[model samples]
Target: MADLQDDPDTALIAVGGLDDPGPSPDKAPKTRPESGAQTLEQARELLAAHPIADGYSGVAQALRESVLYDLEAGEGLLETDIPRLRDGGVGAQFWSLHVPLELTGDRAVAASLEQLDLVRSLVESWPEGLRLALGADDLADARNCGRIACVLGPVAGPALGDSLGTLRAYYALGVRSVTIAGTRWTQRTGLTPFGHQVVREMNRLGMLVDLSGCTPETMRRTLVVTNAPAVISHHPTPVPDDVLRQLRANGGVCMVACTESSIREAADRLDHVRTTAGPQSTALTGAYDTGTPHAPGLGDVSCFPRLISELLTRGWSEPDIAALTWSNVARVLRDADFVARATKSRRPPSVARLLPPLDA
Candidate 1:
């Protein structure tokens, strides 16, 4: 098995669930009486035009571990719920089909599949609030229907169990993005040949390549091998300036996490990224339930409007905020699909041989 070196601090964060089945995002406006209340209302209006498309989340793991949480009312201790996400103006979320590093082989595969099932079930249970986003176009449809589009991905590269077939199976099952989330890939340095094969296969399958928590070396290597846009699902921090330049060149967006800490703190991080790499290279990730150290103020999914309001107060224009919150992710997803269609016409599915698993 290959491990994906992680740099979560600079990784592009990606996704979770929304609904209305027998279990989803629309309602009247919120009238919070906090300070700077007027700017907050403006920010909410802007988000109404360009709602958020959060790139990553680990809430599925949290959800899996807990049995008492409710998705609609958010009655328990979960970081996200339908009202909060809608209040946050979230239009899409990428639920992570996470397979823990501690699990390997069939166990990892089972975990991945179970998480995938869990995400789908969440969407199915609340079709009015959450819709499974199978493609980039689905986001707009989800928004039109007043539902949060739920996308899927697995940061654990080993979740495929060293099998290209499993990758395809995941794609078929709504896993649209993949990251090298392991740490000891094949007991080798950087991505293995099979790993490169995995990247190409994902490209061929029209899936986005995630670089969340990947080291610069691994990130560079993956960048070289992948043609479709790759994202850095960062924990709301900027990467090295040079890597930022390379990522910009690749037309990839660095997903700045918003649900990590105080609105002012997250704003500072977003401001740094926007200044360092320009707004075109930025997107928002809720960073909910990612298990990173948490802080007070603006920490839940419902707080995105407040984050946007802070940016507005800082002289960040509405268009730039829209790009950060929505358009960048939409463009990345569209580009990946376009590249896959053209690439698939020229190449067949990968048939690479999986190497023997190495001891951890």
Candidate 2:
């Protein structure tokens, strides 16, 4: 493990969540604020306004397949948010079962379960618009059926305690991914010996190991050990060059987050990295920091259309944009799901501990 403090360039970006008051009762407006009513008409009139060779339909199709898999959105999303997600062209969303860094042991596990229950309840309430997706196939089915596939993921590994059994239990409970570290570095530093074991177990269990919150050194090391491709659910500040290189080699995806600071910082850096790493190694996410005054009105799922437009303006080809918006993350999800199914029967029960008894 490298000493992160010794390198100023490796410093992580500060990320804090506001107390989400949950979604409002009001329905989302029919049109986006950025584009206005005229822009809405333009989208509807795409075929009439543009020549078929202009590729307007291609961009429109890409948006329809776009999946906001890593929302990091907790219990704040109300029933009304469902329609907003659909309107945003989000085919699927992984609502993060984020356990606070302050939680540990049994409390962490309990909190995670509660978050899961909340998401399930929300999906149940809106059966027409939302479906609980357990795997990549479910997501595809939901998209084909014109429904949003909602999935669950834990934001930190501590939610599993130190028990491999607890980890398997999460998988059984429909948690397809686990962020190895939370937002705080203390929870999972680069040198933490246990982090390596966690990655290996996650690989064996066919769970996605998310390195979004991990320190650069930790992310790099985990990438080296993980057989399955990992996802950086949210991009960190001062992006690590080596991690980008490893991600491309390992066939993982780095999701560029949608926070004011994240977007500003990632703009120049991501462009440079993509030139060498290839677009397949990168994806975009709406890590919507709800309830935060710092980033007012920027957390909406609707921001994705604007992002797509921006990518087009930046000279990103249709295929590259599609890969960033849909296929790359889709591939990772499918791969993880396949591994989980293959390893399910071999998974040991909680009592079949990974470590010997402390007393022994």
Candidate 3:
């Protein structure tokens, strides 16, 4: 299978989940009080104070253009106004059927199905330049057609209803990738002491495993156990931390996005990665975290372009940059039949070729 080469200039930086409204001025305060009630009230006050833009603005649009980006399902759609996010510069996207664990139960599966229907409805409404992407073929088709292809994924594994059967079912429904958790731990395997089984099943099923939002320990454990190469989709390394060692150790890769604040840290991490992994490891720009506690700025996405250019100036090869930005991710996508054909091939018929072109 031909690997998607990493190209920082055209890399797909994974953004918010199905409900994220992009980088909003309405993001809750970075700091919260110890008291739960006070924190809730403070968030409310912030929400009241600065209403985030509902769709794309020039700043957001410019930011979207800066990074070849993809919106993960949890942030929801960018609404019709942010066509720039879908087409202007940002390329492919992934829609998530992300349901928080609290939302599951006897009614949970039904609710998720309903959410999936809503996603379909939204995709159906997209203009010709935007498309719902399923796998590599779909993404390639979109790029060929000059449209942004959208894939399906999730932010939390427990959102799968704690069932490998459900995971398989979602894969059949077009969910090609799944992240273990966000900041908090969950029942999803590879995320906590409780996640081992889930991790095992995800590998066996060939669904792409994302470890972006997991804690360091959980991430390390997931790396130790997973047989498939994974993606650290978003999130940067703490300065001097060698994330590449963790990734390359397991045949995995990292997409390190740089925001204004995170750029220094990203550079620091890259330097450390070079020091630890040598000058020839893979790395790329991630989301635009410009040091704000909450990550939602349009300028955030553009920050990495210059950082990456600077790296090239410092003797990094284009192929190396490409591996970090695109090929590494392409490797993960290849695991899904959409990007590259499956090796084992015979899955229950329902799981066969789950990713179909939305516009088809």
Highest-scoring model, TM-score: 1
In terms of TM-score, how similar is model 2 to the real structure? Answer: 0.71
Instruction: Tell me the spans in candidate 2 whose CA falls farther than 4 Å from its real position.
Output: 1-80, 182-194, 261-270, 289-299, 340-360
Order of the predicted models by lDDT, top scorer first = 1, 2, 3
Ranking by TM-score: 1, 2, 3
> Candidate 1 residues 32-60, lDDT tens each?
33468888888899999999998887778
lDDT of 3 by residue, 1-360 (tens): 222322212322221111111222123333435654553344333322221111101222222333333332213223322333422234454444555456644355666566666555555655465566665566656666766555665534555655566777877787767777642234233344335555545655667777766667666667665555666655444422544566555555554444334444556655555555433234443332222231222243322344443444344443444444433444455443432233234323233122223664
Which residue pairs does candidate 2 place in steric collision?
22-76
lDDT of each: 0.74, 0.55, 0.46
Q: Which regions in candidate 3 have their CA more than 4 angstroms from the true location?
A: 1-83, 86-89, 96-115, 182-194, 236-243, 259-267, 270-307, 336-360
Better of 1 and 2 by TM-score: 1
Q: Count the backbone clashes (under 3 Å) in each candidate.
A: 35, 1, 29
Tell me the deviation in Å of residue 159 in model 2: 0.9
For residue 322, model 1's alpha carbon misses the true position, in angstroms, by 1.0
Best by lDDT: 1
lDDT at residue 236 of model 1 (Cα atoms):
39
